[model samples]
Target chain A: MNEQLSMRQIVFMYLFISLSPVLRQIPTALADESGRSGYLSPFWSVFLILPLASIIILLIKSFPSLNLYEIMVHLIGKVFAKLIITLYLVWIIVFLTAKMNIYSLTLQFTLMPKTRSDFFMQIMLILVFYALLRGSKTIFRFSEFSLGPILLLIGILFACAITRLRTDYLLPVSTINLPSTIKASTSVIAVGGNMIIALFFADKLGISLTKKQVKKFWFGAIFFIIFSFVITVFTFGITGAGLTARLPFPFYITVKSISFFNIFERFEVIVTLICILSDFITICISFIILMKLIQWLFGLEQVWFCFLPLAIIVYYFSYFLSSTQFEFNFLYRYIIVNMNLLFQYIIPFLLGLICLLKRKYIKKQY
Target chain B: MIYIFGGLLLISFIKQKDVILNKKRNLVLFLLLSVCGIALGTVHMISPYIPSIAYSLEGILRTLLVNR
Candidate 1:
């Protein structure tokens, strides 16, 4: 089995991971900020996602066969790279905890409303631990195989919901809302920032990418924008922007109204199951990255020694991070989004700037 | 629940005893993380009613950003 991950697989993994945020956060965040024009925010995010995607590709192209940490070391030197890695460490831990909190909260809101969050966390950790034991490639392969069906299901729901779309809810977009749409697009941009995960796996990509591989990167970015657009459109179209803003999970509600020829009802269960699967993959990827960061930070040979303890920490912090949905919502809206922008976009932009400046020296070293 | 957590930690410590004894850095890293996890878990277990750290941070951030 070739454990070396292809660029296409990385794109698949990213799309898989971005599903939860696309489902849970983007629609409501956009609706709250942009009103009826919120659905346009996904399109607005194209300005940032394209550049972020290009920067990721450039970083991989410039520092071929190097992981993010190593690329940082080459571009900015070791001390600053370690400092940046430490910042990533903090960001990832909080991000992981937040994901866990949302996973349990989503379940509580949708299915098994009575179950303690601790039970969900415990079960999720066990599954994540098992996945980690299978190695990183397996996780990527799982996403590669699963993304197709998930997208197909979402497509079917969209087809079913097309008739139910209220044109009044989405139409009459005055010029005034464009600015707010751009602002609200930050939610989409924040979610799309998960593209930087490519750098984490760059070392496994081997040296040099073909044109086809490059196309996959752009394909992933384009797919993200389209996916976000369609999901938001469906939510706004079916559920209406006002209701979407008020509801926590508007896509779930939007799906509830869809039935195949009035025969297959309660498609919301499929939505719930997809969200759960996305959350599981998201958590698994976060753990892999978290352990990788720890290994890089401490110069440790084997990260397995730290995995159990880290899982325990995440288990407890999941509870400590946000005890209720309201707190989680607040944190997500303000702190997490901004933090993601910093780590995912700004830092990578700066790194890319430095990489261009030091290109000559880097070539000499390699 | 706390006892169960402790039991799992103990089982982990036992299973990794070879690396714990041989590798100094791994041992230190392992111990530090385990201690932090145990302490946080115990704190949450002991005072389940206390407001979460996020709630506190949210209050502070909201005050600073919104109120001001």
Candidate 2:
């Protein structure tokens, strides 16, 4: 508990947690739905990149201390601050519940169909509960510990997949219409919006990011963008856009298509493990944020009080959606799009503007 | 199955009483809350009640503020 994460560990945590396993199936899901909608083209996909850049820039400017909540309080009045913070906390809880449901449902459908949904959720909740109990420093340490092996595995998988790549699949990329292309960019942005969790840890993470650290973080973000783009391109190229858009786990299918000496036949398991690990990390981060936000909002001396309520909320809500398809469709079509804009983009931008205005007013008074 | 795990976790809490009362209290509370959660989960399984409530509230708010 006394251990603090070094800057390297913090950077690694951010990188690994941002490009999480939950994202592996995301491209497939998005491409499947959005591609048909003619929104998978690169032209519009770039819009998706802006909000992440905007959020990161906002964090970098406000850095060293002051989380989104603390910053809101400083910029806005206490009443508005409390109101906004409460809404954000509810959003986080709902978002986390949705994610938990998705992951659990995905696992139930694909890997362990026989397992009861409640059982899967309970196990996940226990893991998240344990992770949250250990606190953020421990979570960061775990990230540091797991980052190396995970990266190495991912590297190997990527290397293997590259050998089987077909460049021809990437052809006719320019054929996508302008409107469709633009919408695809928003999908990419929505995917990248996962990085906003960085804000939850930004305050405790210590703000003094050196030029090197900033460069490294940006490098990681660039790496993630390129990685995603490559995976999409390759999957599309190999499977064809139409087929790629239809596969639920297209990247996994891409991995499945790879055979090195026919010995490495089942690489989908590796993808599954990676996805589960990433999901675990994300859920842990979400749980920690929930606990911290609750404590902050309620002015509670103990953070643990928030955990029970959170666990209960997550547990029950996980079962609320009748099926995996419902969870996936609801999340992608409605929840993520709206939540990403409102909470991730609009709220933060508004708060940052309010801070700027407040500063100017104070300066004028002086 | 959830109840069994919950029971075991509860037992672990009982065994760890010497660690810290504060920690024990939290474990007990979490276990109790999870019990309530299981009940809620069962209720949800039976009815699409919660989302309907959320939707209605959202609809009302949207209607009062602006056209949805």
Candidate 3:
């Protein structure tokens, strides 16, 4: 098995992990905020996400050998770095629990409504344990391989739904709604900012990066924007903004309208499977990142000791965080998105500013 | 359910015994976190109907900000 993750692999991982949220959260959020013009929000998000992506690329290029933690230590001193990482540890724990809760809730609402959520969470914990035991490289590789087919399935669904598109549902955008579209882009920015996850694994990208690796990072960022835009457009175009806003899983419901030659009418099953797969990968990667944060914060030589305990805590806390879909939405929109913006963009922007100030010093060191 | 968690914790500790033995801090931290997990689980088992922190926060935020 491969041990180290390449920049390409990391990019694929970010793309893969963000798929779950892009599918589940962004469409509904956009629809809720901007109605028919919600599809345009993804484009407005580029104004924020593009700069943030550039900052990430700069940070990784400047400090090729260090992860986010070590980069923080170098840029802002050890004490502050540890303090920030400690805060990260807290945020990730909550984030991981939220991911778990959402995954379970998704399953409950879609697949097995009769089964208790704790059962789903328990099974998910076992799968995550097995994946982590195989090592982080396996998780990255799984994402690398899975992303292609997942995108292909989405593409196929979009093609099928093309016939169902109602232009009236998507058009008639007035200049008056432009402000609401910009406001709704917060949902897009919240999910897109997850690209910063690349930094957490930067140390694994090795010492020197080639131009090809940098190009891959840009490809990943652009691909993410296109993916979000296309998904939102399809959801709104087929399902309509009014229904999209009302439904919890707009994309899932949108997929139900797909009929491939009248033989495959139940394509919504594929949507559920895709969601389950996306959520699984997301939870595993988030768990790995959580462990990495703990390792960095506590200076642990082996993270396995705390692994089981942390999983147990996550399993229970998933229930504690949000028991129902309503609570989950409130937590996600009010708490998690804002928190993601802070940690993923604001803090990284701060680091980029520090890197700019110490450019010559950083260059001299390496 | 608690028994399952206990067994898993025991197995994890046994699997990492050598490393935890050498690094006493890891052992302490492991036990501390495990105890916390078990405590949370017991509380949850006792009353699963408890409104989550999100619920409270939503109520507070809605009243404080939205209601105003």
Which of the numbered candidates is closest to the native, going by highest DockQ?
3
Instruction: Provide the DockQ value for model 3.
Output: 0.88
Residue-wise C-alpha lDDT for candidate 2, range B2-66, written one tens digit per residue? 45545654665466444425665555555555567667656766774456333444457669889
Q: How close is candidate 3 to the true structure, as a TM-score?
A: 0.98
For model 1, name the residue pairs that clash: none
Which regions in candidate 2 have their CA more than 4 angstroms from the true location? A1-11, A20-25, A33-51, A54-60, A359-366, B1-39, B45-68
Candidate scoring better on lDDT of 2 and 3: 3
Clash pairs, model 2 backbone: A44-A181, A44-A182, A44-A185, A45-A184, A45-A185, A48-A185, A48-A189, A64-A207, A169-A237
Name the better of 2 and 3 by TM-score: 3
User: 1 or 2, which is superior by TM-score?
Assistant: 1
User: How far is A338's C-alpha from truth in model 2 (Å)?
Assistant: 2.3
Compared with the true structure, what per-residue lDDT tens digits does model 2 show for residues A1-366? Answer: 224345466556656665543245545554655553332443344454444555565554554555666666666767787888788787877777766766776676457879866677777878887887777787778888887887787677667667666666554446444455555555555555665665655665554656776666566556556656655666665566677666556667677777667677787777666777767787887787777776566554565544554576677765553345544554554566677667876776676566556665644533
Clashes of 2: 9
Q: For model 1, state the Cα shift of residue A147 in Å.
A: 0.5
**Best-first order by DockQ:** 3, 1, 2
Tens digits of lDDT, candidate 3, A99-178? 88998888888878999998999999899889988998988889899889989988888888888889999999999999
Tens digit per residue, CA lDDT, model 1, A1-366 = 126889999999999999999998999999999999999999888999999998999889888888999999887889999999999999999999999999999999999999999999999999998998899999999999999998998888888888999999999999988999999999999999998999999999988988899999999999999999989998999899999999889899989888999988998888989999999999999999999999999887777768888998999887888889888998899879999999999999999889888889878877
Which stretches of model 1 miss by more than 4 angstroms? Answer: B65-67
The residue pairs found clashing in candidate 3 are none
For candidate 2, the docking band is: incorrect
CA displacement after TM-score superposition, residue A229 of candidate 3 (Å)? 1.0
